[model samples]
Target: MGTWQLVLVGLVMLLGLLGVLVPGVPGPLLVWAGILWWSMSEKTTPAWGVLIGATALLLVNHVVKWLLPARRLKGVGVTRQTVLWAGASAIVGFFVVPLIGAVLGFIAGIYGAERVRLGGHGEAWAATRTIMRAVGTSVLVELVACLLVLGAWMGAVIHG
Candidate 1:
């Protein structure tokens, strides 16, 4: 793929990552499609490998998400702003502290957002816990899977 095509692929993947936080956005599908596009255009061994890995990973993500409890954010009163904060924090955390940072950042982001919204440490923590139980795991799983795919694509692009 040309540089511009690669950049576009990256943008698609970025949108996919954002889609994970947005309801009914088909995040993983976008990520997978970006990989498919790149692989089809590049036709290189590494591109093919990344595409296969992304496919398998995203398939597993779907299965894992299905096994998890259904999202109850509406009942729990979790807001989209909170999710967006958590997602942005996760991205920063991924770069700041590598793989584990994403989870830590997500939790912290929830807590911080809740703290600001509820205006009490105890209430915020409680809300954070409730929100996590309601929908955090599902979002986290999808985000991590997408991030892994993005990382793999980046590796292939840089080293292929």
Candidate 2:
């Protein structure tokens, strides 16, 4: 591929990483699309194996995130409702205040709900801290997921 094409791919990869920091962007999907666009441009297309692996790398990050957390949460005694509320708040927050609001909103909503359910501000704050930790880890996991997509794209270039 031309140097310009590689530059564009690099830009897409950067955007994918940025999307990880800000909520609501489909980072992995965008990364995959960018890589696929490049792969299709080459005369000798990327191997089917490499393409499949890249797709899996793009796909499995989300799947593992969803499955692993729910299982671990069950082991640790956090309810599904807590997770649901956190997600809902995150979504609502995006509309309400945009950008950083979603992250804060999720944490605040979880804490608020826990306080109402627990009936003590102190206990509620503690539960909120726990939820905050979980959300933070999830964000980190997402960062790693985007990195994996970048790796897969590079691998396609090297091995194709």
Candidate 3:
């Protein structure tokens, strides 16, 4: 039913929003799902080329982001234990506190881990800053992509 399609679109939207909060679960991926579903329905099939191009853009963004400083993640000068503890703490923070806590969790994780493992608050903080900057860059890139996806969806709707 047409309404069911809309429901999937809404699910896509929810996933996209949550994806913003949590890494790994991607927002654009969900948006693409909505796009695909809507297109399959007798909806104005937004050009496949546009969809493919947008996906290509996301791929490029991913590659470029990889080139950037790895933030809050494992890497040189960062031990596996450090990364693992950081993640574990963040997960706990999510349930223990809530929205803001989850965010603070990462920062605290690094600080706590390094302070214990590396025994240097300064070094730990430097890593934290680097990670935050990378995270910021990632969010900006995703925001732009999300805007494009929305525009494409809207175009399909209006033109159809």
Could you give candidate 3's per-residue lDDT for residues 43-114 as a string of tens digits? 333556546766777677667666654543555367777667778877888888876666778778877887
Instruction: Provide the global lDDT of candidate 3 against the true structure.
Output: 0.68
TM-score of 2: 0.79
Model 3 pairs in collision: 71-131
lDDT of 1: 0.85
Candidate 2 positional error at 105, Å: 1.0
Over 4 Å off in model 3, which ranges? 1-11, 14-18, 23-25, 43-45, 65-76
- Which residue ranges in model 1 land beyond 4 Å of their true spot? 70-132
Q: In model 1, what are the clashing residue pairs, if there are any?
A: none
21: Cα error in model 1, Å: 0.7
Candidate ranking under lDDT, highest first, comes to 1, 2, 3
CA lDDT, every prediction?
A: 0.85, 0.73, 0.68
Question: Looking at model 1, how many pairs of residues clash?
Answer: 0
TM-score of each: 0.63, 0.79, 0.73
Q: Tell me, by TM-score, which candidate is best.
A: 2
Per-residue CA lDDT of candidate 2, range 1-160, in tens? 7889888987987897888777788777777777676767764545345456668875777877667656655654666677778789888887898678798778877876777778899988877776666656766787887787677667777776
Reference-based TM-score, model 1? 0.63
